[model samples]
Target: MAIMVRSWERLLLASIHDVSPRFESEVDSLRDLLSPHVGYRIAMLVVPNHWGNAPIVAGSPFASRLRDWADAGSEIFLHGFYHRDQARHQTRSARLKSRFMTGGEGEFLGLSLEEASVRIAEGRKVIEDITGRAVAGFIAPAWLYGPGALEALEEAQFALAEDHFRVWSPATRRKLASGPVITWASRTRARLASSLLAAGALRHAPLQTLRVGVHPPDVRHPLLIRSIEATFNHAARNRRAARYADLLD
Candidate 1:
């Protein structure tokens, strides 16, 4: 008998979501928390205007921070125009999903194709203007999208896009990474418990790509903090932490 071994390394793709001027302190804390465990080269999913409340102006301090991250080689993504869901869903299933999957945070979940297109374009421009570079991609808030959102993304020509299950190229619409994104939830006690448990289990699961999506609200929970550190630590030990764009190559 002959012995053989596989030599490829599994990748760890980590991102901080809902990034906006409003969540600056929380984002700072999360970034600081993740750096030692996962290193600082993590993706940042930016919301140009959050719920139409906070907008990133070109010469603001937050804008400088975005530029610094881009300069330091972090991939910037247009998370959503306004990370709020107010669209009217025609179908019962769509309405239920919009409510249950996310608490009115699925901004693209009910947008028409034209509306989705306009929001994506405006968000991309806002991010690009701040970073002085092209956005790496767009990922809808709550990882939920309607038919029209998909169509708009298909036409956006972004290099990549992601949902809960997979990361794909919007340009070619090719499935790049097929895996569940591991994330924490501090929104509800039940969800928090389940998410922590899932993080523990998924950290050791045999998968090619491990995607970790951290929200600003997560930094507030101590249990979630520990679990997040544990997940990233385990990932750091076992896999190569890389950017979302790394899936392209």
Candidate 2:
């Protein structure tokens, strides 16, 4: 008797995080690299205001590009208003995660529900104003959010939200996918460690939905760039490339 194995259905979502005018050039380069493989299916996690400094305005070059991407089927997600942590420390664990895990990019961590709601609304408005389209979703910086962040996301009416491990609908509370993302770290040692971890995932995490998060800094490192490409190529063998919207569909 001949036996057949059914391959697991898997989804692959790629995203460029911390996108803002500050990293526009790097973001473009990464997009160029990704387009050939995934077309315009990648998502852009945009910072409406970067570090409470540079704000993305309507009719600007960046905003124009965002519209182009959105029209081309790339999703625009409202990342944190300021992709920098400014909330007061609420706990030792939160403080440690901010300082070490996120490198101070977890803007939502430790924020009160009201404060998080206000920021989420503000950021979403800026993106909607520029794109003239409703922002597709929201993803907190570094995939870290405060206790009230989820509540605020629901109140703000975002269709979707993502953490490090899963994507879920804020309104319906339906879990769309379960998978750990493969992403690069910043420093040299950390980058090397991430490369190994990502390689391990490629080798072992088959038959599961996978998310690959690409940051501007990852494009700067040659090794990390290779790792990102390799991961994509490996996933392409069996998994279908997808946008966040595809998951919801």
Candidate 3:
């Protein structure tokens, strides 16, 4: 007798990170593509505090637009206090230089517990000040957090923390989900190929929760844009959009 395997219904959640002026156009494009699919429960990461010397403020017009979207019911996560790595001794390879957040590395990864806690508190304040709403979660820069970082988040009272491919609960220090992540690639062809590959992989896996990550630059590439749209369309056909908050409850 042959046995049949049953597939579970998967939850789809899309996320975007690394917001900046240079990528405004691409961000806008992404917003447009995602607006119609708003029911999918997308999330944006906002950077408000950091150690880098960059003068860009989080309250700029571009950020305001993103905030507006969040106000309209989309989820928003505090990306990093500064998005940049500022510890003087740390060195990033050339390939990673342009990719780091603008200000330099902020105070999370290498700071002492006391220092990290202060930064986390300050960062949450900045985000709340700008958005006029309480932030539900935090995501460390580069998804890199020191051993002390998690404790800092808990003290600051953030309900959740999102890593590169996982959603964690600071309170329980347990992972809620680590789904497939679809992030942007620097090369256009590479982005499309990765998206295509990810789509196929999703089809083969037992349905669960799927999380996709997008950088603003990904939307600028026509091929990548199409691939993202196609991916979302495909997922919608197979599963319903699930909220990250819902999983905790």
Q: Which predicted model would earn the best TM-score?
A: 1
**Compared with the true structure, what per-residue lDDT tens digits does model 1 show for residues 56-89?**
9999999999999888887899998999998999
lDDT of all the models against the reference? Answer: 0.89, 0.82, 0.65
Residue pairs whose backbone atoms clash in candidate 3: 49-81, 49-82, 50-82, 52-103, 84-104, 84-105, 84-106, 85-104, 85-105, 86-105
Tens-digit lDDT track for model 2 on 38-78?
A: 88788999999899787888889888988888878788999
- Model 3, range 1-249, lDDT digits (tens) per residue? 111222455677777776555566766677678767645367777666323433235768856776676677667787766676655434354225424522344445655568778767776676677677877688776666765777788777677787656888887777777754655465446546765677656544554767766777676577667777877777777666666676565
> Residue 22 of candidate 2: its Cα lDDT?
93
Candidate 2 colliding pairs, count? 0
> Each model's TM-score?
0.95, 0.92, 0.76
Ranked by TM-score, top first: 1, 2, 3
Give me the runs in candidate 2 sitting further than 4 Å from their true place. Answer: 1-8
What overall lDDT, based on C-alpha atoms, would model 2 receive against the true structure?
0.82
